[model samples]
Structures are given as structure tokens and as C-alpha cells.
Target chain A: DARVTQTPRHKVTEMGQEVTMRCQPILGHNTVFWYRQTMMQGLELLAYFRNRAPLDDSGMPKDRFSAEMPDATLATLKIQPSEPRDSAVYFCASGPGALDNQPQHFGDGTRLSIL
Target chain B: DQQVKQNSPSLSVQEGRISILNCDYTNSMFDYFLWYKKYPAEGPTFLISISSIKDKNEDGRFTVFLNKSAKHLSLHIVPSQPGDSAVYFCAAIPGTASKLTFGTGTRLQVTL
Candidate 1:
């Protein structure tokens, strides 16, 4: 089955270090989304892209968080000078079209730990 | 404010019994709703979805019912099995393929 794939399933870093996560969405899917999951906050949409164009990133903290889809096969979410509060599982999801009702397929996710 | 809410933290049901999970949404603009199941260390998998235009959608053992007036939805699983145990999430999409706002998950435990 075609599934979204994410790199570095697990990562541990210092509080001020940089953390980068990568994802490959399912082929032929047009919409890509980045989300964070923590025990307290269920799931927050950090950013979303359509046809490699970023649609909305208001959910992301402008200073430390950045998301990009350099190409259709790859999407990256990077956090610089990460804080302990940044520890969470980051997920990448993709959908078939620009329709709200289309079901999204998600990646296993990258679990990040900032100490 | 939480747009989607799954108030129950967990639910326990006996095996072979029917399990009904509920979800409520505050956003009237949300036109699409979906239910997802997630295992530990795994991504949330699509279970079922119902559009605003339809009141209900079903696939095999899983059925999702949507009530537009109340902005509520429920997932019904018949003959629940141990394998069905997992965390379930309710998500709402406000616009066409827009960002999904998810609710805190509800863990379903199917005891044998």
C-alpha cells in the first residue's frame, strides 16, 4: 500500500539544538499537512500546503518553526533553537484534492524529545 | 476554544458488543467530519467519514452518523473485537481541503 513516510522516527536533542523532520506524501496527493501531537494538546495543525504552495501557517510559531515542501515528494519541518516545550510527535498527512471531505493519509510521525 | 470535542477520555466495552463513540463540534462552518483510529506509535488511520450533505455513511462494520443541526457525529462499531482497541479522534474541516482541527482522542478498550 502507498503510505506517507517520515524520517528519523525518533530524535533526542538539547534544548537549544536544531531538529529537522522530513516526510514523503503518497504519490498523486495534492495537499500536505504538518501537525504536532502532545499529551496536553491533542493535535495542532502547524502548516498546510497545496501543490507545493503554502496555504496557511498561522498555527506555527513564526520565530522557531518553519515548514516547506521543496518538492512534491518531500516536505520538511524544522525547528531551530528548540525548546523543551517543542517535544512532541510531528505528523505529516496528505490528501487527494482541495476538497474538505477527502480523507487524509498520515505518516507514522517523528517523535522528538528536547531535554 | 476547541472546535471539535470528544469529551470522553476512555471507553470500555465487552467483546462482541456494540461500541458507540460520540463527537461534537462548535464550528458551524465545518462541512466535513471524519473519525480516525490510532495505535500506539502509529499514525492515525482513516476509519470512516460523513459529509455535511449526508446524515450517515457506513462501511462494513463501521458506521458514521452526522447530525448537521446539532453539529454532532457518532461512530458505531458492531461486534467490537479486542483488535479494535485504540485511540479514536474526531476531526473537522472548515473549508475545501483546509486544515483539519482535531479533538482530544478517546481511547476505546475492547475487553474480552
Candidate 2:
């Protein structure tokens, strides 16, 4: 069964450290999404890319967060000068067919903690 | 303002009984809705979904109902099982091919 794969299942770093998370979307999927889940904010969409092109990133904090799909199979999310407030589970999901109601297959997630 | 809301933070039900989870949306433009289940240390898994054109959809023991006029939807699981316990999130898309907006999520506990 194909699934989205996220690396570095866990990460702990001091505040102000730079952190990077990577994802390999399921083969054949054209859309990739990055999301952050926290107790206070729940699940929030940080950004998404379609066909290796960023379709939206408005929900992400531009000052610290960036998401990119370098190619059809690889996507990345990076946070610079990370803060304690950035602690959360980051998820990557992918879907096919120009979006629609197609259910997204999500990665297990990368749990990050900033001191 | 929060567009999708699962007001109840948690719910408990005895195994073998029916469990109902409710969701409300503030965006009148939303035309598609979905439910996802997540367990500790894992990503949310797709449970079910419904479109504006349909008021109800079901697969196996799970059923989703949509009330367009009230801007509300519900998930009902019959004969709830302990394995069904998890945090359930309600999500929506304003239209086809649009991004999703997720709610805070509701935790469900199925006990014997």
C-alpha cells in the first residue's frame, strides 16, 4: 500500500534552532499538503503544493516557515529560528486528481519540540 | 472565526452502543465535508466524507449525515468498539479542488 512518508519521526531542539522536515508523497499524487497539529490550535493547514508548484501558503507564518515540493515525489517544510511556540506534530498529506473530495493519505508525522 | 467546529471536546460510550459525533460549520460556501480519526502519536486517518449534493453516506458501521440548511453534519458509529476510541476531526472544503479547513476535534472513548 502506498503512503506518504515523513522523516525524523521525532525532533527536539533549543529555541532559535533551524528545523527541517521532509516528505515523500505517494507515487502518482499531484497534491501535497503540510499541516501542524497542536492542543491550542488543533490542526491547521500551513501550506500545499500542486504539481510541484505552491498553490497556497497563506496559513503559514512567512517569517519562520517554508514549504516546498522540489519534485513530484519530494516535499519539504523548514522552520528557521524555531521557537517553543512551534512545538507540534507536523503532518504531510497527499491526494490525487486535482484535489476534489479525494481523501488524503497522511504521513505518521514528525513530532517536534523546541526548548 | 472558526469555520468548522466540533464543540464537544470528548464523548464516552459503552461498547456495542451507538456513538454520535456532531460537527457544525460557519461557512455557507462549504460544499464538502469529511471526518478523520487520529490516535496518539499518529496522523489523522480518513474515516468518511460527504458532498453537498448528498445528505447521507455510509460505509460498513459508519454513517455520515449532512444537514445543509443548518450547516451541520454528524457521524454515527453503531456498536462502538474500543478500537473506535480516538480524536475525531471535522474538515471541510469550500468547493471541489479547494484546500481543507479542520476543526479542533473531539475525543471519543469507547468503554466496556
Candidate 3:
């Protein structure tokens, strides 16, 4: 019964709008990851956090995209002035830290559409 | 460059048969490989995994085989069922970052 949960299962917005997605990872899990999925690029990692602290955001566009884990149970991915290229399914996953080989558990993703 | 590749975009198999899905990688540093199964409108689910140290790993009906020399690995599902119809993705990690580099997934259709 334990699983990651995400909000706003689908979203549609005009270009240059702000979009925010939220995730509630499985209880007691310390690692969370954000990924973007597109037709051309397949799946790409955007960011990851360990123990509610950002570990890697190398795949994210710093100018407009930011990810944060304000608390242990909640994580968020926000995009400001979103562009058409940003239209894709965004997924959030969580797992125990590396001490366990941490197989990520994913939530049903949020599908974003930019007009 | 695509570090991992699943050249076959899709595969079709009949029920009660074995389905083989292949994946190739270019990075030799990748020491761990995993397979995930995803249904439409759902996120990918962990299926099985094998570390470079071992050539094969199995759990129930799923098995993963790794070939270090070729930088290749495969997932075999025995007695494929219609419920097994889903996209399968192969992933690898270069180091211990917990970050996974994934390949374009292969869609499998198990028909009766």
C-alpha cells in the first residue's frame, strides 16, 4: 500500500505561465527524484534530493526550473514562465538512501501541456 | 550520445511463451542495471536488477542476464501473460550516485 503520490495529474496552460507540481513520497524514504519524459528525449533526470536536501540538479535548467524538498514528506518542482518545450510528463520518485541500493518507487506522473 | 539503447521499439509475443527484451549500453563504468515495467498512465515499476559482479539474477518469473564484455543485458519473462503488456525500460548507473541513465523503452505486447 505504500507508494509515492503526486498532485495535479494533468495540467494545461499557456506559454509563459507558472506551473507547480507536488509529490508525497512513500513514508520513511529519504531520496526523491524528478524526471521529465518526452517523445524525443525519452526520460531524463531533472533533479534528486537526499534527506530533503538537494543533491543533484545538473539536468535542470537553472533559469526557470527549480526543485525543492521543504520537508521530509513533500517535494516540489516549479517552472516559471514555462515554454512549449517544457511540455512533457513529469514524474516524481522516492526510495531509501543508497545504503539499500534504493530502487525508486514512482508515482503516477503529471502530464503537462503548454499552449 | 545515448549511453543506453533499446534498439527494438516494440515486441510481440504469445501467451505462455517467453519474451526476451534486450538492452545495450556504451559506458563500461556502469556496474548496476535494472529493468522497470510501466503501463500507460502509470509510472514505471521496478521489475528486477543485476549488478555487474553477477552475470544473472532471477526472481520468480523474471530474470536478468548481464554480459560484461558486450556491455549488454536482457530481461526474460517466462510464460508471458496479457497482463504483461507494458513498456519496459532498462536503466544503468555509472557510479553510486543513485542517478539512473535510462534507455528508450521497448513496448511489449503479450497476446492471447
**Candidate 2 share of real interface contacts:** 0.71
Tell me which residue pairs clash in candidate 3: none
Off by over 4 Å in 2: none
> Residue by residue across A11-47, what tens digits does model 2's lDDT show?
9999999999999999999989999998867899999
Model 1 Cα lDDT, one tens digit per residue, B1-112 = 8889999989999999999999999989898888999999999999998779899999998999999999889999998999999999999987644778999999999999
**Chain A TM-score compared with the true chain A, each model in order:** 0.98, 0.97, 0.96
**Local error of candidate 1 at residue A68 (angstroms):** 0.8
lDDT for position B26 in model 1 = 95
Per-residue lDDT for A105 in model 3? Answer: 93
Report the C-alpha lDDT of model 1 over A59-98, residue by residue, as the tens digit: 9999999999999999999999899999999999999876
Model 1 segments more than 4 A misplaced: none
TM-score of 1: 0.97
Clashing pairs in 2: none
Better-scoring candidate (TM-score), 1 or 2: 2
Error of model 2, residue A13, in angstroms: 0.3
lDDT scores for all predictions?
A: 0.93, 0.93, 0.93
